[model samples]
Target: MNKINELSYNIKIRNTLYFEAAIGLSGNSFLLLFQVFKFIRGQRPRLTDPPIILLALIHLLMLLVMSLVASDIFMPGKRWSDSTCKFVMFLYRFFRSLSLCATSLLSILQAITLSPRNSCLAKFKHKSPYHMLGCLLFLSIFYSSISSPLIKYIAAIPNLTSPGFIYITQSCCLVPISYSVWNTFYTLFTLRDVIFVGLMAISSAYMVTFLYRHKKQSQFLHSTNRSLKSSPEHRATQSILCLMSFFVVMYTLDSVISYLRNPSNDPIFYFIVILVGHSYASVSPFLVLSTEKHVIHILKCYGRTVDI
Candidate 1:
């Protein structure tokens, strides 16, 4: 009885954390999409513009879908039927696969951006923006295709034997890790991706620091000249660096929590993991919008106009 009670408490904590994370991520994604849309409309839409924007939009949608699933599966007195639960479970798996693909592409882009001019990826940098756009699209499609098959095992079914908990109502149906080898492979793959992401983050930070120093030196040298200012590349680099930094920080925390979790069962840990994961998507948009000087200026101007 004590063990059961402890489990119940853990499960409740886990669900609450997951719900909060989902809500936060959803909010961030929404804000990112809005900022992207506004930027595209207000400025010229480039070849590289669509995929990240689309990804953000898709992620936002998935967050909403997941929220509905969570409510139906986890919330008491509002549980979904088997069929509905199953559908939501499938959708969550499908979207999660796509999200991973999208994130992978984003990481690759960051790596390419930082690669040396002599590197193979440098060739892509010189390609027309349209070509870069095509590359991103192609890469996204290939990654998504590779991951699609993995979603089939996911299901949303009630835990008839254990009546009280929510996550049990519907959970991802992963293929049984029948062998230690498979588990090892899975761990390696996850580690590889994390390493790649870490490299990208490091490169981004290096570039930002380099740019900052360069800017300072240039300003000092040209102190007397009023005409010389930071270039567009500097501005764009700053923005991208800021975005990457935010993603890296949030994702690192999420990954750490997930890594610490026991796969067998630990609801409180699961809840915290979910909360962190979801919070990123929702908060990202606001971060982008708030950080952009032009957007802030526009908002201030609008306020003044309204006052007038």
Candidate 2:
């Protein structure tokens, strides 16, 4: 009965991972396609659209690679080649880093968009698409350099697995590094995370303050109107604020779970951390879609097309 229960537990975790992947993939696909369609139709893209598109693409690829990684973890009978393990793990790390970069860019872009003309952020309002993309490209290279060390560490587990090998998946494990090298990489990773997350937090706070001040000024200017609806900028700012908040929450939760599980051998904590780490990517597209009237219109058009 213990064996049977353990088997069932593994199956449940595997199914849940797959389900999350499916939802993430579908939502991101729609988002990507719609954004591309808008660009193709010669519609002037919003400042936030570029980062949103990049983010969706990153999340889509991340989910695809994660699903592949999940198979290696949950399927005990399956094995991956050393080269395959290295390649998949590298892609996952690269895309995960890009996802953070893109999200940070999105939040910053939105904050700039909402900034008043007299504000310091207004200077960035006229930045060309090429400029924004260049920033993303630079950050991508920076993160790729930082994350490249993982390629050297990840390999297929040999038959003579040592206690030093930390399991990343059923077929792949991280070879232990020296204490000095480990601390160096750890510091780099921590610095990268702090910079991006700090940018997100600061941008989020700026948006909140901007919105509140704007609201108060508007109320004072129009004392008779109690039913002043939020403008499009306000709505969009609120949406991105929600997205950033959710991302930070998921990040913190994953970090806590990871720290707690580091000294233990509990598969439950391991699976929970994986789920938590991907939760932002899986759920963010739906959150954005729910806030966009254009996305709603796109869905309605699809419904009409189906009906016809």
Candidate 3:
């Protein structure tokens, strides 16, 4: 108890955290609906479609995760009970992992969708949705539940701590587990990142290669004025590229911070980590939605009908 008290430090909750969370939640939730609309109103309705469905699920999970973390920030006080702290930590970790997995899976699916007939990834396109959904379910259950029992954390219990510990009591923290059991949780998370991030990087590069090889042929076959950018597939590929770019940047920054993370480290570092981590979720929908030409078509139709 004394050692735990010595390690705990007071964390100050700032107003910016709440503001970012609120705006992100509102924007993502609304655009998530628009994503669904895009799917439902498509020329061909696909109830079992993996690409559209997985994308929506990713945004939905991102929104839910932002809600959980933000709601905790806005609580009346920094102090939380054992169960509450554990719950917060669990939801945060589990959902964040799922979001990354889904995003990586999305890039792979996009590449497969755009692949040539003979490409290896093309065969898996039809089955990707089921596999992605199943993986999401498995990760959610495994991450959320498995860590609860082994959870080791320190809460700021000012009233219960020794007098010497009274000065710095502020918030609860989910402490790291020992190396003896690291293989079960930490190792899995590391491998997951290595695999998914590698897949996303490789697949994205493959897409670029495919596009480059096809571009000249496409231009020669079509009109000189025909732009590859006019295609829906091209637009989607660009948007997904932007999303992954943002994710990579943030993930890199967060990794650096984690390497430097320590009990005596500045709270601002943690704040920066949280802010950058959520930026992808907050801004990705708008970035992706902007690429959809259907919105423009619908608006033009409405204007013409009104004018008539």
Candidate 4:
């Protein structure tokens, strides 16, 4: 009886954590969706171009579905049907795969953007942005389709024999060693991408520093003259810095939590990992929208105009 009670307690805790994380992610999705709409309406620059916008939209939809699943798990006497649970689990796997593909595409785009004129990627700069978007879409779709078959293996069965496993209705994960190996490889590849992101962040910081130094030197050189006007590059650099900061902070938190978690048996660690992962999606839209001056200006203008 005591062991059964402990199992129930752990399940409750895990479900609560999942629900909270889902709520947080859902909120983030809404914010990002609004920002995307505003960008489409010309209120803000499309920071995420067409390919990224499509990826974000897909991610938003997945989060909404996950939020529903999490809620069902948390609410008493409202557990999802076996088929529904299996479907949600499949969606989760699919979305995770898609997220990874999208992130890789984003990294490639950034690499191209930063490439020198003499480099191979330079040829892409002259190509239309739509062409790049098409290429990214193709890559993501190909990878996702290749991974889709893994979802069919997932099944939900009643747990009548196990004490600690009763809460798990769907068995939707890859075989343990295989999954771990794949995860390790994926993490290695993502580490390379993370290094690239870190490089971007460092370069952005350097650019900001250079800009400040230039402004300071100009002020000293032309004392009593008018202050230097900010150039468009300066503004773009600032915006990029804001974006970089958000990525660094959130990714750092995720890395730290991931390192601390032992994925095999510790439900608490798993809960924390999920929470940290979902928190990033929730905060991402606000980071992009609120940090941009034009978006803030548009919001202010809209507020005043509506008050009139």
Q: What pairs collide in candidate 4?
A: 28-282
My TM-score estimates for the predictions, one after another, are: 0.67, 0.90, 0.75, 0.60
User: Highest lDDT among the candidates is held by which one?
Assistant: 2
Point out the higher-scoring one by TM-score: 1 or 3: 3
- Model 4 ranges off by over 4 Å: 1-48, 76-86, 100-122, 139-153, 161-237, 252-270, 299-308
lDDT of 1 at 79: 46
Least accurate stretch of 10 residues (summed lDDT) in model 4?
A: 168-177
Candidate 4 lDDT over 1-308, as tens digits, reads 99787568766865775566555466556555765676677853332354455555656766666555444433334445556656787676566555545544454554455456897866866665566666656655655555455445444444443332323333323222366755765665466446555655555555566567867888878763243333433444454456556656766787787556453545555555556655545554555455455666888999999999
Residue 102, candidate 3: Cα error in Å is 0.5
Q: How far is candidate 1 from the true structure (C-alpha RMSD, Å)?
A: 5.6
TM-score, cand. 2: 0.90
In model 3, the runs with Cα more than 4 Å from the true position are: 1-13, 45-78, 127-132, 138-171, 175-188, 219-222, 225-227, 265-267, 296-308
Local accuracy of candidate 3 as per-residue lDDT tens digits, 185-216: 65665665777689889988988887787787
Better of 2 and 3 by TM-score: 2
Runs of candidate 2 with Cα error greater than 4 angstroms are 1-5, 223-230, 263-265, 297-308
Q: Where does model 1 exceed 4 Å of error? A: 1-42, 46-48, 76-90, 93-133, 141-153, 156-176, 181-185, 195-199, 202-206, 224-232, 263-267, 302-308
Root-mean-square deviation of each candidate, in angstroms? 5.6, 2.9, 6.4, 6.1
